[model samples]
Target: MITFPKDFLWGAATSAPQTEGAALLDGKSPSTWDKWFEMEPELFFDGVGPNDTSNVYVQYKEDIALMKKMSMNSYRTSIAWTRLLPDGKTLNPKAVAFYRDYFEEMIKQGIEPIINLFHFDMPWWLMEKGGWEARESVDHFAFYAKTAFEQFGDIVKKWATFNEPLVHIECGYMGDAHYPKVHDFKRAIQVGYHTLLAHAAAVKAYKESSQNDGEIGIILNLSPVYAKSEEPADQEARHKADLIYIRSFVDTVVHGYFPQEFIDLLEENQLLPETQAGDRTIFEENTVDFLGVNYYQPLRVQAVENPRFPAQSPGDFARYYDWPEKRINPHRGWEIYPEGMYDIAMRLKKDYYNIPWYVSENGMGVEGEEQFLDAQGVIQDDYRIAFLEDHLAMLAKAMQEGSQCFGYHMWTFVDCWSWLNAYKNRYGFYRLNREQNYARSDKASSYWMKQVIEQSGFEYGGHL
Candidate 1:
């Protein structure tokens, strides 16, 4: 008979680049994705690109109705910066009108819209002008955030300045998942620093302005790191991974400063990001009102003496290895450790001042989902049901133990195009049948989710 508070939020989350398909329509300019797909379409899986998404631009009304039918009390999605500002400065009137109508309709349907300003869809013009590496780019992002707030402030009350800034830093700067890929360690640190500065500036703008009276936050994809063995070297590697991957942004946003050990390591290695005098003060005064955590898996790390990269990357400290007894999602090849969710809740309560937060993104993505469809066209996703049930059980236990978690938002509402993976992995309540003009059909999980939301919790062993 476990139950959640009556006010607990149940929602679904999506992003602009993954869902919105009208890439160049309505005065929308070229994002890095549009340009990247133009240049290197081969890099994208199955040659599918950004503009081939689920067509939310044309189907948003139907989608919102689906969300309402599914009993979603709230919805989270981002505004494409490219769509809003064609040249990085001016606000397109059409873009403004579209978002206003979009938010209003959700509100009318009894669903709260939580809008994120940036979701890694960096404007191509900005990328050409040095992107997050150039200090001035921070100001440009702040301007975008300000414009979004002023325009949509009347309709949308909850705002997120950025979604997974760490992904923007790691995947874009240090790996190949995002555009303008470079592997310079110092530049990676700079991108992280400038991104945080942009976040701080946006937080400050939201608080100072009288345009919107909503809470502002950032979404982070955080994971708990575990050492491979109980050795001194392995422990050191785990600590290093924690600092680089977790503490860098979390500490700055919550505690208003970088971890001293993190700074010391960067300084010792000459990889510290260049910063101005007033940046510290900005972070100090403009901490966020809440946090949105996107957890998928925990990290497993061991000390690296020989290291994979040429000592220039963060690889010198740690290297990843598979945990022996790990249960994996065969389709996505990602670890599925539900207990990590409990560890995350307790860590936040113990270390991060018990800040108000939520499971902003969590879901199971399976490949080749059509084979599971029953005669009624519902994808019988018992795996997804079990995956969510186990995680939600952990969440319930954590809440009972006094975590400040306020909500749980599934990864998405509909099957949409992933960044580089394209439609290789589908994580959605409704399966999108692209052959039928992106027509969505219910998966078994959708009805199950509605029951969970209606009951405010699910039973241990029951039909739902």
Candidate 2:
């Protein structure tokens, strides 16, 4: 049987907008999502929006207790920027009080809290000013980071600058999945570059403060790239895909600079983002102390004959091709590839100075999960259990091969609202009952997770 380190952390993670229901309550202002839901309600699934979440705002106490019962020693959650700084600058006293009480309760229950600064919930006021593409937003975000550090840095020792920075840029600028739906490669690069700047700025602010000595990091959703075949064309296509999808953020945050080839390619197309003075110094000086990896699947790239967009953006030089024979998660429409977890770990070990890291967000989402409910009021989510077991085995293998992985926090604790997809896909241990006033019910995987946490390892053939 494989055993994890004695101090290995096992918990669940959730973002603010995805779980907290009070979108505009208690001196909280509207985020980009709040404004988007009002303007385009039909785009959301089941007509559910940000305001209709797990109501963690009012039920965090009970939620923490549930976490305790589940044997979660660490709980990863983000503080909504709008909730803390209603206008992105001014502090909301009520919001501050709520978070202080909420975090203290988690600590009182002996649960370590990992707080993330930004998690796709941009304040509506900031988005109007070009969001991450604007240079001014960098300083604005730095101010919020400083305020958060000063306020909660004592209680929160582990901090993350941003969660899935690439997702916001891809969904918002390069694709139509998020707000300000503009499909422009140039704008996407600008948004991505400014986001890295904001991260570095936040790190700078955190270090400048005379607060408690704590750890800071960034969470990246790294999807390893693979070529469809050994053909030169496919390999070339895969290289470009890696440059855009993988190296774009990983290289910067880990290595403190953009990939040289990526810069040359963008320069060739004149899609380079506007930059300011001393930005390089900020990046060089403020690198993350740790990294949080969110791996879901790998990208299978194949050369496209008649490329679109002049090979300037993702899916232009090469497009993702699904392997038909590969295992698939029918519920969420994503490939179920556990090997990608090991690939990510090895890549970090070989490429990024072997920095300490953890699996920050990895979980499966199933639609119509209520159908799995049994007579005992528990959801028989054996599929989730199997998924976790497979991935954990792979993670354990990576650790054996010398990967510095300290924890594993699944995508969420309780089934919460997802952006755009809404509540259509459930990725929580505790199922949320929509008809019964958002009641929480334990799923089969929840019990399995409890054992894994308490034992600090999952023995082969142990209660499966």
Counting clashing residue pairs in each candidate, in order, gives 0, 0
Question: What is the lDDT for 254 in model 2?
Answer: 78
Estimate TM-scores for all models.
Answer: 0.98, 0.98
Please write out the lDDT profile of model 1 over residues 1-464, one tens digit for every residue.
Answer: 65788888899999988998989999999899999999999999999889889999989999999999998899999999999899988989999988888899999999999999999998989998899999998889888888888888888888998999988888888888898888888899999999999999999988877775889989998899999999999999999999999999899898899999999888888888898999899999989889999999999999997864334787798999789899898878899988899999999999999999999999999989888999999999999888899889888999999999999999879998988999888899999988798999999999999999999988866322
* Residue 114 in model 2: lDDT: 93
Worst 10 residues of 1 by lDDT: 305-314
Query: What is the per-residue lDDT of model 2 for residues 126-239, given as tens digits with 9 covering 90 to 100?
Result: 888889988999999999999999999889999999999989999988788989898889999999999999999999999998774999999999889899999999999999
Relative to the true structure, candidate 1 reaches a TM of 0.98
Alpha-carbon deviation at 413 in model 2, angstroms = 0.5
Question: Which segments of model 1 are wrong by more than 4 Å?
Answer: 307-310, 462-464
